[model samples]
Target chain A: MNNVVLKCQSLKKTYKKKNRKLVILKDINYEFKSGHVYAIVGKSGAGKTTLINILGLLKKQDSGKIFILNNDVSKINENKASEIRNKNIGFVFQSFYLDPLLTTEENIKLPMLLNNSLDKIKINERVKKLLKEVELEDRETHFPKELSGGEQQRVAIARALANNPDIILADEPTGSLDPENEENILNILKSLAKKGKCIIIVTHSKTVREYADIVLELKKGILEEVSRD
Target chain B: MKNYLILILKRIIRDFKSRLVILLIALILLLGTIVSINEKTTEEMLSKETYSKYHNRLYQLVKKESYETKKKDIKGIPHIITILHEYNIASEYLSSEEFKTPNTDHTIQAYTADNLSLPKIKYGTNFPDKQGFYMVCPINMYPNSNLSSNNINFKITNKDRIDMQQYLNKTIQFQFENVNNMNIKKESIDIKIVGLYEVNKHSLEDNTCYINESAKKYIYDTLNNDLPSYIEKSNPEAAVIIIDDIKNLEEVESELSKIGYRLDPYTIIDPNFLIETKKINKTYSLILSIICVFLLFLILFKDTKNTLKYNKLLKYLGAKDNHLYLTNLIHNILIILLAFILSLILSFIYRGLLNIIIYFRPFLFSKNEIIFSITYLFKIFITIFISTIIISILNNVYIKYKLNKN
Candidate 1:
């Protein structure tokens, strides 16, 4: 039997605008196991982002049970939610949201800095290893502005791995990159998945879905599992 | 705890670097506020000290009639020793012939024979030893009505002596009589200027001439000795009593009142000085505290709100809320502390500037030895610290509510 890393049941998200309730997600049930890259594919406004936000604990689901490693997340408070996000989950954004003021190395070291549990030497060692792993060792001292789209995204990837999280959540990680940079990022994501990290990528690209171990489509507040070669 | 502190510090450094201009502006504002507050406080303290010293040295006393029953004996009552003694006293009369220039307008204070001892002189002389000797003038007499220095000419029996040397060997005419019945022409006599003496500066009467003991005796003896034999005897108009200590003045006054003597209005010279000083100090402190609190609250609230908004973004970037809060607090506290330190330095600089001004113009201060006293600095620190802490906590509460709502 496969080890379950994350499970979501009856997750619902409703948005209220001008006193009108618009249901973005309804009764969404999903299960994520270890060592598999899951891709949630959908067009814009299809609630892919909403689902990703809920899974990352950035937003609360209206009515749901979310269990991470057999711990129910809905019962936890904000601080515990943050703790779970900090220790077990990593996020990569479509905008390559690197802290613009920090150098690439500092950006990569941000998670450890925030956690503050790791000493400077351990942080430095982890950052160095991640920088080498992303093939951006020489670009560590450069800021986000100085780096290209692919290089910045690579720095973002290195930052996500800084805390050695068990789950990686990427929201359209390659949506801003060029064709060549997209392939590079996809290959990196694939490699990360091979290292036993449960990588979940939210994307509409067929290329990302091809690289993912499982592809799920969100259509009209419903989740449908699709097979990907 | 160590880890948390380190995390907070790192985040503070990052945010500071990110918003360098805002941080710099905050620093300048903080420094300016601190410096202004500290300088103002120091100036107030100096003024209080100046006023206190002068008030203490002056030893002014005022007499006010509390009841009609105590009115008759007011002047003779030694209220400084006991409240009851006020009944034996009479009123003090101060009048000026001309109100303008010192030379034209001469001030004359006429009191009973007993009231003469109230003014303790420091230098020059009081009345002469022999009968009908010389008139003693006030020292520190300036052209202005206000007494500035002890410099005055002596006029003995309508003969003006510009300098004291000329009057040393001369004999002068003197007269002493009741204010109501002054038969000065009939009883006037001549006495040699035996010696000179000085009076205390704190006395109520500035310019005074002492009547010789023998001279006063002669006036009383001549008046009383002839009164019963040839004319009607006159009652003693008033008497003056000087107490050893001013603290028991009220008790002495009350005691005198119990003896069927009407008590007069009296003044306590000692505590009045302290009371005036306390009033001035309280006003100064209150004004400064209000200003400091106003400025500090404005700065702290604005800065904290902006910081909290930034911290929310940090929280979204995987930082814990606690981490963000701590970073915001540390950064703000550090800026405030820096501003306080700079302000303290500025206060000393202000003191130095005041000293320089006083040095060039020595008359600005009554005393030539004006030193920068650190006694008020500790007061400033305590005031600023308390004000800043209160403002910071208020700001924190406001920011927390704002961010948490979002």
Candidate 2:
């Protein structure tokens, strides 16, 4: 029996706007096993980001049962959710979302820094290794402003891997990068998946879907498995 | 815990590195120091002024006089001393030199029996023996002069001129002749110059003197021994008394009046004067405190508003509510600590400057040393701490509500 790292049963979220309830996610049932790369694809307002936010424990569903590592997450408080997110999940934003004040190395080490589970020496060693792995060891001291789009996203990738999270949630990770930079980020995500990390990418890019073992589509608040090739 | 604190500290240091926050912190520190030091110094000045005024107004010796016979009534007299003994009252004998001098004409010169050992002596000691010895005079003769000169000239008889310098160690013949042809004589008196005393400059009374109790008794004896019946029936002219409670001087006067001694109703010193002055000082201190608190509140309000804005931005950076609150608290605490230390140094410097002013201009401090009073500093600290906590809590609650609402 394979270990399922995360599962969602009948997850639903709604937003009230101008006296109308707009359903963002509806009856979404999904199971993510360890060591698999999944891609969620949709157009604008298809609720892909909302699904990813719920999966990353950054947002609360109106009604849902979310199980992370066999623990019910929907009943957890914000602090506990944040702790679980910090320990088990990592996020990559479309804009890189690197703290502009910190350097690339500091940005990459932020998760571990916030968690305070690792010493400075270990953090530095891990950051150095990540910098080397991302092919940007020379750019460790460079701030986010000093790095290119590709380099910043690579730093974000390194930050996502800082805590050795069970799952990586990439929300349009390559949306702001050029074609060449896009390939660079895609290859990094694929490489992380090859290392037995579950990679979930929410993106509009068909190229991102090509890298995933399973491609899921979110349409009108309904999630459907489109292809498993 | 240590690692968490270190991380928080690092983040705070980074936040403080911002030029705006750094400048605000510096300004808060500088302003707090100036206000604290000024408040402390002002409180000290006010306290000293009030205390000095109170001390001067309260402490004094009063002597009341009236004749033993021809009973009269006195009531509601201010600051009077009543005597119970009738024979102890002695006559005022003017020396020949003092009688001839125009400067001593209007001066009310009185000689006491030196029974009451008052702390502040106003020039010239009591006569050594109770014999015919007489000291020159008290400072009340020349109340304005603080000079220490002992030389005084006096006339002994209508045809005789004697200087006190010549009679210092010799036996002198003195006579007391009343209007009824009765004469009292004394011989072989040695006069010596003892210690001199100066009255407080704030004293309102004129020239006064103290003679030996024996000398006073001798003069009284001489006047009463050979005097005629009519002269003996008349009032003694000068009387002296010791009072128990200085505060109930009016009651003493009424008590004396019941026994036939009439006192002139004149206020020696205003009793409520010191209390009124202290009330004024307290009012000024209260006003100053209110102004300080108002200005402090204004500064704190503005600081808290800016800090709340920064906290909002920090929250978006993945900081929890506690982290945001602690960061702001640490920042303010650092500024307050720095300001306190700097203010202490400034107060020391101010005290030194005051010392310099006092040294060259001794009259400025009224001969008192200048010292930095920290009583007001404690008040300021408590005020600031209370105000800071209140403002911080209000700001936190407001910001948290606004953010959640958003």
Candidate 3:
């Protein structure tokens, strides 16, 4: 009875490599529901990252229809796409892209800065809540460069949730972390999905697949759901 | 909006140190161009207004031929407050009957002019009017009976000289001579010595005397055989017209020119000259402004490039192109506003320093003084503001393109 937060139909993406048409994804159709973690696993050349980019609205698909919350957003312009991204989608990259000039709290407050509906007091309150949620409330004033790899990733996660996005698209969110930090990030993502957020993660890790509620494998420009005992 | 402004302020302060040196240089350049153009133009305009209001209304009507301008010829010319007719009479024909000392060493010349043209009188005042036989004699020259041999060296004392005061209010007989058709005619008149002028060390003005218009006419009558037909030739050989106001100068000049009288401006400067100088300064300031704009572009370009990483991050965080654009705009505006304020302050300091220098060595700057005005400051602010906006937009476009590409 869970609601479908994101759905894609007949998605197609291609790249030209050395004057040859190389197909990355073709006819990708899926409906992602809330309260679930969808792990997309693939080989190095498989199009897992490309699919996640398309789903996150960070990259344009050559041909497809994308719907978020029953609204068709496949042909919307960049500005509208950005509004959707700000209001509905959040992204966590593997590199942990944090503004070096801004402190941890300021980075978390960045997304809300563009949201006119949120006043200063509400934004500050939300930033503090996210900082505490990511267990970095004590490091709110620390800049990215001053934090450790795990701490920086925690700040990035807090930033990803700044506007309380309904859908989280994480591409190798823990790829650069140690096992201990990776476990911590995975647990946090799992908790977010339990709270009715649609979490889509692109990764090659076996542990992430085990943690996911539904695991999909992308191979040879096709997607196949894998059954686990 | 409040949040956006806070972010902008924080970024500006965070990047303050990195941009400090270039910002300072930009401030100096902006202040230099603004002060240079504004001060120069203000000086030119103020000087012209002062000159035109006080002394530039005098014009000499040149004589084209032996044809003299009759009083009837300039009867209808508006703003002709005065039409001065000046003439000179030889001093050899002049002798003070009561004083009895005649100088054979140097000739003393007597001339007539308007009161405005007369030199500063040390002992008495200028002629009250052109009528009557009034005269202002040089303290060392007239009444040769009073001068000691040492006084001839021009070691003339000031107005308090007792010997010079002796000639005041005294009447002296002037003998005038005329040669007509090989007939020598002579006449004499008694003229009063009313004033004395100080002998200037730099000129031969001490050997000269200033006579009234009536005395000049008496000499003219004696020289022309006292004939009424010779009266036209006796008109002032040269005439000077004084305009009542500056606004009426061109009209009066055109009227005079239309009447076949060639007028030479004594103090009124050519309007074309000022226009040409203004054009040159405008172009100069424009070039400086362009350079200032280019400098700002470079600064913004570098800053945007440096923050390209952050911009990319913001883009990934769902910032629209215009959102990023607005951020860059606010950033640039803050810097430009800071530079504008600093430049204004520095320009005032620059003007103050130049004034101090001029005060110490007045001859260096001469008549032109540095004048500061709010209009100039407003002009400079508008220029830099608009230019910074254009530069920011251009910089924004480039940054937008680069962000999309990356």
User: Which structure among the candidates has the greatest TM-score?
Assistant: 3
Kindly report which residue stretches of model 2 are placed more than 4 angstroms away from their true locations once superposed: A1-3, A100-110, A116-128, A135-149, A210-213, A227-229, B16-29, B32-378, B398-406
Which scores greater on DockQ, model 1 or model 2? 1
**B1-406, model 1: which lDDT tens digit per residue?**
4544554445455565424533443444334444444444444433333322211222112234333333354445453321222222332222222212425223332222222342344444455433353333334321122333232222222221122334444555433344335643344445443333333322323333334334444445554564552112322233234444444545665765565443332332334444455566556655665665666666666566456655654565567766665665665555555545555565455545655564442322422223333444445446756776667666667776776655
Q: Which stretches of candidate 1 lie over 4 Å from their true place?
A: A100-106, A135-149, A227-229, B1-310, B313-323, B345-406
When sorted by lDDT, best at the front, the candidate numbers are: 3, 1, 2
Residue B156 error, candidate 2, Å: 48
Best by lDDT: 3
Model 3 lDDT per residue over B1-406, tens place = 7877887677776765436833664565555555455645554553444333323556777755332444468876887766665333223345444533334322345666557556578887788764678788777664332333223234333432235477788877766556778876667777888888875433434445777777777777666654763336645366666667555766887887787877776664664454565676566566666776666667767777676776777777888888887887777777777766666667666666665675432432422345555565556557767887888788777887786664
Alpha-carbon error at B21 in model 3, in Å? Answer: 9.2
Q: Model 3 in CAPRI terms: which quality?
A: acceptable
Candidate 2 collision pairs: B96-B155, B97-B154, B97-B155, B123-B197, B140-B207
Task: Please write out the lDDT profile of model 3 over residues A9-80, one tens digit for every residue.
Answer: 999999987999999998898899999998988899898988988888878999989999999999999999
Model 2 chain B — which ten-residue stretch has the worst lDDT? B147-156
Candidate 1 vs 3: which has more lDDT: 3
Task: Count backbone overlaps in model 2.
Answer: 5
Question: What tens digits encode model 1's per-residue C-alpha lDDT throughout A46-108?
Answer: 899889888988788899899998889977887888878878898898998777667898888
